[model samples]
Target: MKLSQSQSFVRFWAASTTSYFGTYITSLSLQVLIVANLQGGAADVGWMNASRWLPYVVLGLVAGVMIDRAQRKYVLVLTDLGRGILMALIGLTDLFGTLQMGWLMVMMMGFGILSIFHDAAYQSFVPQLVPKDMLTRANARLEQSAAVAESSGPALAGGLVAWVGAPFTVLVNAAAYGMSGAWMASIQHASKVEAPAGSVRTQVKEGLRWVYRHPYLRSLALNTHAWFFFHSMTGAVLVTFALVELGFNESKVGFALAAAGIGAVAGSFLSTMVGQRLGVGLAMTFSRILYVPALFLIAVAPSVDSFHSPVFPMFVVMSGQFLYGFAMGVEGPLEMGYRQTVTPLSLQGRMNATMRSINRSMIVIGAPLGGLIADTFGFRTSLTLAVAGLAFCAIWFWLSPMRHAKLDENQIEGV
Candidate 1:
């Protein structure tokens, strides 16, 4: 059946798309708020990034186990509501002139905690909405809409921030999350999984063993962990570099980021074709390699002072971000589809959480380190390290069993 024919998936898609827009808006605006409004720098960005993911490190395994035992739909709605409230509170604190770095970090941690449940449930819930064979297409459709949102969200956010200040801009995400929750509440069709019969600690250990023991998953998880760590470091410093070093304002930065969205849209459109032609593993490997050049452009980008027109540097950086986003858009659906298709329904939540907990734990570690490195060594230096790290991931994928990995009916049947 076509995805459009599935009402449940339609609602899920709508909810996800709405949240994506809000997420992008808040992501950019919050960075601006920290740097421009709060007078925070790289270290502060690192702290904020780290705080948000810290819960994933601490509570991730438990949340995954709980999600496996509970209703994923309810989990999604509740977390969305919780996140909405937190976003609103953040906006209110800034409005009241009481928002400090400490307060912001605390709020981010709350967001992260909810995210632990929300994200794990979100990934695990998707297979219930569509056929295993259709997972790639389903994910592609979701990414297409998300790419569109990414393309436009930042530009819209830039205008919102300029008009209403960054704090008020975040209120937009709160409203979006509320709507997402309501839409999710409307999804009535979901396949239920039997709760695993074990203690939470035992279940968590089982989840860990499942991921670490699977050959393809082990490599994928390790490679992804490394990639996220380095990518996050770049993220921690990029906005600061743009605003401070490149001399770009929120508007210009938004436009540059929008290029990523545009590239993502294109990538999403092409993902299925590419995946079919190259096969899943090769497609993923190709996308992984693209990050090397994409980040290299950013690392070597000439500062504004080096160019007579600030537009020149912005153009180069935008080109890089475009490629960066394209690579992500292409690989995301394939990776998620492969993971979901291979794993048993019973282990979905645990598998996702196990990989994500460690993956994001890297963010908790890398974000701060990136910030510190950027602060001490410089943005370019930190970015150079990130580029090298991404290059390493590409090489690993090329040489590892992942390059030959493919989906098989046998594998999907709990092999």
Candidate 2:
């Protein structure tokens, strides 16, 4: 299939890319900032991190309903502007030496709200910009842009924080958000789509009811909920495991993670091909199956015979990450395309949000559970348990309704 492009899509994508890079920078800088200045241990850091994500667990569905009722570009612009202002405030507060834990919590809460809006709007807007046949390619390109930003952006932020102060590094992120807002300001589409014309209460219920009533959505919701639940457990403990248990240096951890970008790029490029060649159902099935092997690598990693075996363990870690990322990349576009095909455009925001909320709730539950498990057992054991959960997710799908479902261009009933 031929690729399609638009100036609007270009403008929006550029904005998105800049904003994504900014988010990575902000995230890295925040961790550095807190660790360098805040007292207490990894638990404290985990609490702060968990708090930031907690809202997604709680408010994702509501955000989606509200956002879907409004113009997505406007929602996007507002979110960018709000975050830019908030980051600027953080920089200013820190510069004045008036930063407090309470203020930081407030800032994080505001940040989380904006994030909810931004993600919901972005997901709902993209399908409108391209044709149905090109959904996989479009999502792939977006994933590639995000991977590039994420893979290298943290190192850049880490360096900036190391040389300058962490607070000043936030300015870079603020500028990126400002640039995103400025570029997005000129978008001409005006988000022609509107909610079903009715009272606000009825419209909201319709969006939720549409998703819950659909068999495909029901299966997807359950599958993704379980998948993210386990994945978040791994995320909760990974950095600490790498740094504390393995005694790896920051640079090593960064380098190991950066190497996975190559896998992400390959997987992103291959996602559409896999879907076309294997059929969307089989492609998704394969991706889900790959996780069992990919995640188990860490559990089964052999201790190196030589201290000179730094490269070998690093290779093991990176290879595992690569496989995990690749599977995710391959699955994303196909899942997105299938979801878009099944739902009406008007329902996109709420449906995405509901699914996302379910997923995030699992993450919320899993991350703390992971931390507690690691605290009680060991990091390696926690990781092994997470792998067990991944295997469970595949089993959930294999025996459930998703195994038999095919991607249909319109709604089909009862499989």
lDDT of 1 by residue, 1-415 (tens): 7899999999999999999999999989999999988999998999999999999989999988998998999999999999999999999998899999999999999999999999999999999999999999999999998899989998889888888889889999999999999999999875668999989999999999888888788889989999999989998998888888787878888887888899899998899898888888899999999999998998888878888677889889989989998998999888999999888889999999999999999999999999999999998999999999999999999998788777766544544
C-alpha lDDT score of every prediction, in listed order: 0.91, 0.74
lDDT by residue for model 2 (178-247), tens = 9899878877785667665676567657767877777767777778888988887777666566656665
* Model 2 stretches with alpha carbons more than 4 Å out: 1-4, 90-102, 165-168, 199-201, 299-309, 410-415
Whole-model lDDT, candidate 2? 0.74
Instruction: Point to the candidate with the largest lDDT.
Output: 1
Stretches of model 1 off by over 4 angstroms after superposition: 410-415
The superposed Cα distance between candidate 2 and the true structure at residue 338, in angstroms, equals 1.7
- Candidate 2 clash pair list: none
Top of the candidates by TM-score: 1
